[model samples]
Target chain A: MNAPQRIVVDPVTRIEGHLRIEAETDASGKITRASSAGTMVRGIEIILRGRDPRDAWAFAQRICGVCTLVHGMASIRSVEDALHRAIPSYSIPRNAEIIRNLMIGAQYVHDHVMHFYHLHALDWVDVVSALKADPKATSSLAQSISNYSKSSPGYFADVQKKVKTFVEQGQLGIFANAYWGHPAYKLPPEANLMAVAHYLEALAWQRDVVKLHAIFGGKNPHPNFVVGGTPSAISVHSSSGAAKARGGQDGTAVNMVGLQTVQTVIKQMKDFVDQVYIPDLLAIASFYKDWGAIGSSGGNYLSFGDMPEKDIWTPDSFLIPRGVILDGDISKVHPINMDDDNEIQEFVSHAWYKYKDGDDKGLHPWKGETEFNYTGPKPPYEQLDVDQKYSWLKSPRWKGKPMEVGPLARALIMYATGNKQMKELVDYTLKTLDVPVAALFSTLGRTAARGLESKVIADAMQGMFDSLIANIKAGDVKTFNEQYWDPASWPKSMKGVGLMEAPRGGLSHWMVIEDGRIDNYQAIVPSTWNAGPRDTAGNSGPYEASLQHNHVLHDPKQPLEILRTIHSYDPCLACAVHVTDPEGEELIQVKVK
Target chain B: MSLEDIRVVVDAGESSPYQADALSGNAPVLLRELAEHVRQLMAAGEPTAIDLNALPLTPADLDWLKATLGEGEISVTLHSDGESTLAETACPGVWWVTHHNESGHVVSRFIEVAFVPELVKAHPEDVKTGLEYLESLIFDLS
Candidate 1:
């Protein structure tokens, strides 16, 4: 019997923030155990304390640059929810809801596309092999997959030349420090070349589509978020000749030109997702069929449904349904009782946080503490003490179960709970790949689910836009409900949970507003659920379980397989930490007696 | 009603403490990279360019960098996508190039360590096309 070799990947690149993964592989190179550690900490919740509840979104929005708009949306939704619960008339306009949908839906499509092409695609596609590809064959291969119009032989040749020039330059830039020639990369030269071209195209595509956010929210990457409704105002002058005099309506307001731009961007987004993204996803996924059976998270899934038609209070109107699926049972979907303390709780037994009562006790977000207790080995160390506090992320469990969140969870809930469009899309993916329904539980399935949902959300964005237009046409241009704007109409103390299906996964911001100020604010992000360490019950997180399931590192030195499974979750570790900087003084100085 | 009138600023004392200076402690690191790039160009005679847009350089850092490198004799403007300026730094073989989109937004910026920046030079295919055009003009004259 041979001893299991431990492989550690500290500071995983191409992710939003710092994440370290340590896996132990057996004699046959199959991973037996894995630990995920979120290395950075930011005291966002503590900073939000004593701040105006309405202004908390601006601060919370800085959680992650990649997940830019989600935290802002959630924070505003928390405020809105708290105020609405207090006052019956605290509701946003229909146009506001539609606009919010459009914004978040765009986020889903944009984030998923960027994640696929820029982040996860490199795990499967070999760039160095792409240099040897025949441009003509690559064009044919691309044309056969999708009519993206950029599939001309000359176009591929030019791209190939550009890449050749870049490689010749000797500075690979972001493409450096990657496991380029690793055996885990399975795509052929032509496929790799096609994918490489789309990678660059997606970068440009994302830059243009994110302008939709800027149009509505006033900027991309931490877009402006208002409490009751969208921040942008609708221009009445657009219908009359006054708009032209005002330079085609105010740039700050949503006018005909801005709407036209939104429509064009949506069309471009839908076309690219339909033509390039999905087709490329299918083409590349067909080659890596074995990943269909690998990286399963014990078949537990959760999705706090998003893209609401009305508001967060009503779950029935959500495009992505909220439910919990335990032990791979698609037939039985359990409703999420968010208010119940035991239903959704965070434990820090194996994490770097301390609960006043005990580390093993799970506390609801309403009573969640942000106390930091570093009990593991210091930084610049070789390994983590997996048995002790090894991570900054507190393990968030739904009903005492380690449930996987994000695209795969949402996809499964949608399929199980019967979302027509999502069902057809998931079925189509399975049928095209010739894999079974169980394949939807693996790393490849997780990646495919992201593309499928992106298409659904992109298509849904058109409906949201049309609804907004119709509302505006019907002489309702009210973008904000200022009835709740005055904090004087607020209750003395109130708490609310803002749940949304962030592009990454189920994200919820729990806020306790006391006397018009934020008493406590805690955001339980998707990555915390996916990348958290072992809980008190000793249940490994989604990342750890997936790595231990069927992951076998061909070369432990080049752990490309580990990256594929982890990147599948689109891990944003910066969103997970709720503590202050370890080196700096405590942001709030919570006394631990 | 004007954009300039809407002012909202949060003063965090002399320094924000949260926002790190782009080149404060890392000027030497970037200078070291530039030096290595320059060294490679000198020893191997291989040209290289650093994408300034890719780096986290603040506006002040950019000004400081420009001041450190200073200006050279050559400065060329090319109207392609929109407008591009390729200027040589005081240090020979170091060029500062900035490219803008059609809307005049700075799309890409780079620091090129080359005798002539790549964007300023005509491609071999374009040169061939230029010769063909010249031949056509001669034929018309004849």
Candidate 2:
């Protein structure tokens, strides 16, 4: 027996934020144990204390640059819930509901597309080798796969030229610093070129699509949103008399032009998902079918449902129902209770935080605390002191177990709960990949589930837009309910939980409002659930446990295998622990006593 | 009859001809220039950098330029001193680089048609220092 070797990948790239993964491998290079750590401490929750409850959205929205609007939406929902509890008559109009759904749908589509092409594609596609592909052959291969519009010999030739120029200049830009030509890269040169082309196309597509957010919410990253409803009001007047005579349907403020742009964006999203993203995912998955055997975390999954069809409070109206699936069972889904402290709790034993009672105890988000207690070795250390507090992220456990959250969790829960759409998508994808249902528990399955969910959401956006337009045409243009706007009509104290399914996974924000000011705020973001450290029982979190058992690294230096596993979770540590130190200096100054 | 008595009918909120003309500015000449620059770069591998801050551009014009040029394969974020983001337009080599100050305000914006924007490149001195540090570490370990 050989001594176990330890490998560390600090600052894992291509995903949203900062994350570090340390793994110990046995003699044959199979990973035996692993630990995940979030290196930064996000004190946004602490900053939210004593602030105006209405302004919580603005501050929480800044938590993550990638999942920008999700936090804001969750924050507002939390405040809105608290207010609604005070005044039961408060409710958003149908138009507002439809628009919110549209925005959420757009976010899912845009985020999922970006993740597949920009973040996750490079894991499978080899860029350098694409330069060697024959443009004619690449076009033929693309056509054979899907009848996408850009699959032409001339188009591919142009893409190849651009790649060659980038290579010759010795500046791959975003493609730089990648483990290109690695043994883990399984796509053929032609497939690689095709994916690279779509990748560029998606970049352009996303810029246009994000204009939907801008048109409706005033900006793309961290868009404006009011507590009662969206900030966008239907335009009722225009410079042209004829346009105005047409009842302002063709004017600004989410009018004809805006709706048309949204429609175009939706079509583009659907077309790309169907033609480029799905085909690319299947082709890439086919090449790496053996990966189906690796990267399964603790077999429990959790999802907080999102995109309410009628009312946000009604779980039955949720498009993606909330439930927990245990032991990889597709037969039963246990119901999740957000209000139950015993059901959802966060522990800080393996994290760099302390609890008032004890580190071993788990506290619910409503009662969660963000007390920093960094006990790890100082900066420039080789590895973390894993036996003690290693990560800034608290261990978020569902029913005292380190449950995995994200697309896999959402898909499995949906499938187990008999969601016809999800079941069909999952079954078709498994059939196409020629992998078993058990493959859904692996890393490739997680990646494929993201693409599938994007398709499902993209297709659903059309219905949301139609309903929103119907409401607008029927002269129902109420975008905000101002009854709850004034804080004077509030109770002395109230607590509420705002939960939503972010593109990465389930996201929830808990807030306690007292006299119209935020008493306490805690956000259990998707990354915190997936990229958290160990629990009080010393059980590894999703990122750690997923990397355990039989992940054989070809080269520990590159560690592309480890990255493939970690990136499958789409780790966004920025949302988990975001703090900016402006002086280009380290904020922590620990004195060894 | 006085001029006031002989009133001409006009639409409400409608501007005078001169005011309307003033509002309707010239065509986006800079967008034309940008497109031409991109074409030149694609045809002959030559690089061009246009400083957007120096140009007389309205928000509408900027939106037009972005929509026309489209986005490309790569977007990068640099977090040092302040934050800067560089994204390529659909026109392969055309890149848009925006630098934000500490207060999260846009300080500089540039559109460069090149293999990659220069600001995104690692400093040569820093690279040398990194190599030296790695060597020192190896020596100490040995």
Candidate 3:
């Protein structure tokens, strides 16, 4: 039957970095299960094992060019927690927290805006449809939206011209490989025109917001963070050495004038997150009414809450307390237990690690064993099917369960907690978009909720920033604590897991120090949780479970719909591997070992 | 006065015979010499702080530098009219000096460095890289 129709989509278009999807269907094309395979596995874990604990944070951040700071925060905080280290006081002022929140808010805006317009837009907006849209109507409509105009005359006209140029030149950004003009690629021509125009605008603005990271953490993608404390140098001296860790004060904050300019920039960027970003999300959600029924995955959710106390940077007193929701039930919040944090274990069985049957199952660092000898990659699943068992990724189970991550998990946790602002914004959004009250539980809800959270986070950040400025003006700004304790001075054994709610979801580092070196240093990153393969019992990873039963239309060649559903999860498969044939060809296969 | 320091302990398993070859790549000779110096210093209290301002860093130090500092710049080059206007290197304020055998070795033990919190605050990004570099250097290469 035409060689069992195989579709291999390598270098998945319109996402940061690279990924490939290979799926196969049976004869008469009814369809069997599919294997989501990953082509790249550049040994980030093994490389991290022997490095300095602090350096691990920076290196880990590089694992994904997109989720950089999240990794950095997770890694650093993990080490600090393991060592029972704490930063100084006078660093956790409202301004300090606000500044941190602002940076994070900026990143969220940049990532979400980029995700909506650049990556996923093509799935719904046919680029070719822009030519048919009345430019005059587009401009008038754009003008009507107070947030969408350019002061420059004929500027809207120029943006439209650029969209036309992009379409004509076929420069689809990294979206070069995405399905731009395929059927099932829904959305009206006008919608496509509007989205395409915004895609171009967001690209430029995303850069401006990214600079926010540079101002604070010191770079985009991976920024320098303050763990166990705030970042910035001495607010007291505002000079050499004193103002080292602090981003402001010292020469770091020397620009009183620049602060005003920076604030203006942040406000402008904030306008997009509040006005354009959220509205765009709500607008898009309106058309995909059925997403609620299709996109939900797993019953277990986790959050190692972030944002510390108003005047404290102690790991003990984190902002978002670590808690897990079992079976969609948010009845009571339990503290994150590293020992009891079962349900999550990586089965190197299908991955490139030598372990007992490839299920490299272990609790975490403190309680974990130090047997890191390597053999080769093994098929984690017990049942063997050579055709699909050669990938380097392991199937990790959370509480022996498949847990979903990303903004959805964060949104759910926030939603369950009665976050008044989040609830208000989401509730209003649902009404404005004409979605069912319950649609807040679906995929589109996740997409919109993440954008809405950006606003809440931005507003919160402004508070943190101002407080920090006041602290600086009050003559206090030391965020670094350089205390080194002797390994022999105390505990020979301490097993602790450092937790944080990374932008992607839960991020943790399990560390064990014996005789002073990292006797066992293992990290369960967000990507690892999101993109794992099947466990021995054969439960799918979070994204895999979400993709189950997505009705594949007539031709499998046009998969932009399924891709949009999955990309919404923002799979950082770089850290997690998937099943693939040794031939390195396609993604369609049920033959998993 | 509170003592300000950040300890970076590296794994020095390369001395294990099974991994002699891989451990001593372009580094063995230099590390051996540094190890000898560390072995001598072990009897004294281990000084984990290394002032970069006072460094003519040896090969072992270089390895430690790359590991700990990562791929970020140590200095910002402010330019005027497209020309280098100011080039001030970060002091990296504080440092760590790792003595081998947990400060027990007398001859074969070696030492590497990382950033102390003070220096880390100065070049915050490098603090992490430096710590990582120490982790890599002090690891049991075997």
Candidate 4:
């Protein structure tokens, strides 16, 4: 007797957040259908009701532990928009913008490094495979780029021995319970060993970079990054420790200047991006060129775009231009005004609630509604088709079309707008990485571009930081808010929108208020744009539509093909998070069908 | 019988399992509605996302579904037999159906929750509210 097909991967570890994927095959064992289930409901939206508008940023960052900074940005901007605070600056002061840029850049460094080694690597490089790796070859690869080559079994070689010992001791808790001997473990054992070494090194650096966030804002996981202005200001004199000194504490050290701590880290990361990361991606890409086609949903691209002026938070001097790329061709490129430019709505026919048609219009976050219904009853789209009703996320649209938002989108938007530095960097990176310029147009290109862009931003921030230090030495340090503008100072009747290029992708916060209490506050987070469910017009989310065309090359057991495509979206599920509804009341009492 | 001792009756045979129609009705619209409602409520001053894994026993929530149905049959692919008190007096189908009903309720209310047995077995402390779920799984209405 043929056993029926059954596959369940619960508690997907490593990626930050709770999501379970349940995919099943029919009688013949093909993935005819699948559903990605989000687990955990803290009722964050429910908790935010009626809170003071200015305090919304502090509360919103609590939504996810990973993308807390983006949440903070969205939350702060939402209030800023609601209050109609025309953030002052022709160009945010050079020192202020540089300070802001370096802080945000530090966050990307934390995210990308953690992502490359921790989340996606173990899928291909087995924990068990490390025990079999040739230690000398692994050591050589690390030493080649590290510039600290030692004939004696050095740091990397020692790290490898420790890992092998653990693996031999059945202590695979590092990547415990993973599919160790899967067919996708194709890299030479030494590469796997080298990657494992970097994995540990990256984790430490990830932790070390938080001081950057703490110095500027409060802390990270979610840094307290202000949108219109930063919480911390610029200064040269260091009687008080503004931020932890980079590698040393005393002023005598070459790299231990105040903001320069972040500057140096950014520099280190920039070198890694330019010299190590880009080349590493190319080498990895060489082995996996087939991945280029797995996640091409062919949706138009968009970027709310970012401005990195002297005032980095305000929407003034843009690093990239705004608008849409329809069907891979440049279409209508217009200034982004959420009011005249955007239309958003929610559809429940395919969801769990009972509503008359058109009952739920798209309301920004503050004015939005979140009512609880606990019924493991019908699928949301039971009224519609099952094919359409799988995800809990309501699809978000830019001008009612599936538009991809990420580095690739941001880079292309920058190029289309003719920003000289962004354009030049894009070309330079393509040549430096030896990737065709056109490759910068795809998903892998987007992933690689994010790292490269990080380099560009890092380089720019370093320049800004240097100038800021010079200004401070010249006794021109500016921090702290001016006269505390009571809520009355904000234009109550007016409405506004704010945009940012968050780590996950493009982010926007829109607000409208009546008498200053936040009559409406809506934020389109990166994940909302990336993992968006189907929209009202039945358009699939960029990731959703793209998944349909991917070819799962290996057995379903080794889902590298799937994970590769999905992770390329660089999805920060933690950025927007996911929510699944509860079953309704029938379970309380017995019922006869 | 006390609601706790009352046995559930599930339909038998090789047919498709008894449908939890009540559970099904809310799946699609409730989450988005809850997202909206909590959003509006936050505006109007309520901040709560529907807990997908936590079912309500409050009168307003399940009271209607329970009042209308009183008791309905459901079929579930079995995991294991319940406790002695469960198996001693209740039909296996009855026990399974009752647990399924309550499980579905809990599943509906939670915005996001984990109840898969294997996953629970792995990290049960973080996810399993075996105690919270016990009341519904048992047929007592005290």
Worst 10 residues of 2 chain B by lDDT: B1-10
Instruction: Score residue A318 of candidate 3 by CA lDDT.
Output: 45
Counted clashes in each candidate structure: 0, 6, 60, 88
Q: What docking class should model 4 receive?
A: incorrect
Question: What are the candidates' individual DockQ scores?
Answer: 0.02, 0.02, 0.01, 0.01
lDDT of 1 at A91: 81
After superposition, the stretches of candidate 3 with alpha carbons farther than 4 Å from their true spots are A1-6, A24-32, A85-102, A143-146, A151-153, A169-177, A226-231, A234-250, A253-258, A310-321, A330-335, A341-343, A357-390, A485-495, A577-593, B1-142
lDDT of 2 by residue, A232-307 (tens): 8775333443433333343245755566667777788889888988888888889999988899886888899888
Report every candidate's CA lDDT: 0.85, 0.81, 0.55, 0.53
Q: Which segments of model 4 are wrong by more than 4 Å?
A: A1-9, A22-37, A84-95, A142-153, A225-228, A233-257, A310-316, A330-335, A341-390, A418-443, A578-593, B1-142
lDDT of 4 by residue, A459-521 (tens): 665665666555655555554344323566655464555567776777765555555554545
Model 2 chain A lDDT-worst window of ten: A578-587
Query: Which is the better candidate, 1 or 3, if ranked by lDDT?
Result: 1
| Deviation of model 2 at A354, angstroms | 0.8
Tens digit per residue, CA lDDT, model 1, A169-230: 99999888788888778888999999999999999889889889989988888899888888
List the candidates ranked by DockQ, beginning with the highest.
Answer: 1, 2, 3, 4
In candidate 1, stretches whose alpha carbon ends up further than 4 angstroms from where it belongs are: A1-3, A245-247, A580-593, B1-132, B139-142
